[model samples]
Target: MRNRKTGFILVEALIVVACLVALMAMLAANQHSSMRETQDRLRQKRAESAARSAVAYVFSTLTSATPNSVTLNDNWAQLGGNGNQSFELGDLTFRVQIIDANSRLNVNVATAPQLQSLLVDQTMVDSLLDWRETSTTPRANGAKDEYYTGLETPYIAKLASLTTLEELLLIKGWTAQKLFTVQTDVIQSAITQTDTNNRQLPLIDYLTVDGGAPNTRANGSTKINLGVRGVTLNQIVQLGLTQAQATQVFNRIPFNSFQQLLGVPGLTPIAQQRLLDAVTFTAGNRVTGKINLNTAPSWVLQTIPNVTLDIANTIVTQQSTGFTGLSQLATLNGVSPTTLPRIADSFVVGSDTWIVRAYGKSGEIGTAIEATVVLTNGKLQIQKWDRLNTIGIPAWWNWEEEPTSTTAVGTGQ
Candidate 1:
């Protein structure tokens, strides 16, 4: 009887000990998970703060630059190109990149063939154009009011210009990857890739809604408005026109369009380009998707109708100084009488819109914000801000390769 009692007691004690061990294990796991989550939250807060600072820091370089000569070589573009430039803020790191809206093909102004350059087929182009049309009739290959309305989760066609580039996804057969993916591979070239690099970049990289602006000089000086004879004859002569040519050209306006000057006799190509730069006959404050000849990527220049690679390269080599943006291109080696007018409409000299992408990171946690910014009348304003949840990294930090550089950049940073 004594042995039986002792054996029972030992068994009960063993069972209790096993139960305590299991309970302790569960508690430890819960504590570990809680710690991890708290760490993640702290990282996130740091990232958010850094990302916002990056946007302000990067754009400060731009507002200080000369308006007419803003180009790919500018500090903002250099910092943003190829990869994100990094700056350290306290314990966190921030990255900033910039894209000129005027550098890309503006769907609002691009012709059908111009659209074709970015796409593989006419289906998306035709459907996109049809969607933009106010007319009820759809192109044969495109979806319109009827097709969109018939979907299971139906919505009507947008029937106008896209207010955002993301609107492309709403069109028939569009997908996220087709619009936003950026491919990575080894490549080398002297000219830092802007628009024309050979990479198979996503359409989103080459498309923007902010690609238009008021027709004025970069310094906010109004282009010499020629409508109703507002410009003086001497102003015309100063644009490189002969006295006879200036008088004839001056008398011809109240011109309907800038194209009218091309028809005037004895105005050389230099005068033609200078005249285009300094005047506008049309009534609107805006034009879209015209090339900023001073800054466009060589590939973008080639995309302009009748702009050959040689011509694009020639334009790429010359520097445009002062207020005459496109005038510098008129007398380039490849620009002849045959090529000038054909490609004339493709040129605009400066940009008012810049797209800023900034991300700040704390360890692996990150926050990104994309903003559309406009510079007008000597003031800078944010037109829109889109929190980019999945815009991805500018470039993976090679911390092991350059441990010192992984440190803070710049004195203030």
Candidate 2:
């Protein structure tokens, strides 16, 4: 009986030892997890700092330099053409880029046909429009508050215009892959693509809320509204038009589009510039989504109502000399009298508003600053600034990207 008792005590001691070993293992795992969590938090904070600092740097640079116009070849876009110069704060790396905002499609004011050109399904396009309208009424293919509220997680439609591109993900059918880049197999199978490029530019690259500006001239002067009151023939002649050309264009009581006046036979560049400086079809001072013909890529150029892919390519080819005024546009081969009236109002030679994007990464985490910049009083001023966390780093940069449209610029602190 004593020997039996000894054996029982020995077994109890073994069980105790096993329990201690298990406890030690649990403690060790918990400590490791805690350390990982701490590291992640630190990295996040650093990323946030990096984003804000980059924005501040851009703001300061613009304020001091005060560029009047932002174009594709400007130093701001090139970052002094120095790709090696980058912000390196410990392990974080980033870059800063200035994009011509007007060189994109403005979804807020785009017509239904224009929206359809984005290759979005009619349902998604209708839903995107429904989300922006003030009313709760849903389109035939769109969702209102009801559909959104019935979702598993339960959310509401924005019921207003989007302030950021990130808000697109909240829309019914839009996804990160659709907005930023096309990288995943799931996306490849989901959306039927018409683009044949090895790497297609996403819809976000061609869309923006702040893509255009108020119908103001590059000189900050209000353009005369020929749609309401007619300017005198003297005013037309003073703009460098000959008496016959002036009378010919001026006889039209009210001009509808700049093309109506600009498309006159043999109008000089100076005359075209003056007509642009002095007239607009829009009566009121509302914002417009006129894409800059001087700086737009072929992708953005093709978004014009009647611009075919070949026409867009032709225009890009002629951009070597740059269109200082709309006069040069009429001289292009594809621009016919019949085509001029249809597309004249959609293009502009000068642009003021731009997108200043600062983005960077640390390990796998990414951050970005998207700012709407406008040139005011010969200085760059911030219109809207947004700091976005969890931004996906653009993949087209190193993937032999067609162009730098997808190149990510950022700053680090």
Q: Report the backbone clash tally of model 1.
A: 0
lDDT of 1 by residue, 1-413 (tens): 99999999999999999999999999999999999999999988889888888778766776765445467666667663333346788888877667778777777767777666656556777888887888888877778989998999899999888888788888986667656654232123111224333444455655666666567765556777777667788888876778998998987888755456677888877678777677766566666667677666676676677777798787777633322455565777877776676677677767778888777889888887778887765677889987766534532211111222333656742
Cα-lDDT of candidate 2: 0.66
**What is the per-residue lDDT of model 2 for residues 1-413, given as tens digits with 9 covering 90 to 100?**
99999999999999999999999999999999999989887877777676666666666555533232334555455551222245665677555666777777777767767777664467768888988888888888888889988999899988877887678788887777767774343322132222324355556767787765446565446766667655787876876778987887776758667757666676666666567556677776444577877677777777677787778878878776566545556567887756765786887766667777766556666676677987665667788987664445344221221223322344321
Q: Largest lDDT belongs to which candidate?
A: 1
Which residue pairs in candidate 1 collide?
A: none
Q: lDDT for every model?
A: 0.69, 0.66
Q: TM-score of model 1 relative to the true fold?
A: 0.85
Give stretches of model 1 more than 4 Å off: 80-84, 182-198, 218-220, 227-240, 250-258, 284-287, 319-323, 391-413
> How does residue 111 of candidate 2 score in lDDT?
72
For each candidate, give its TM-score against the true structure: 0.85, 0.74
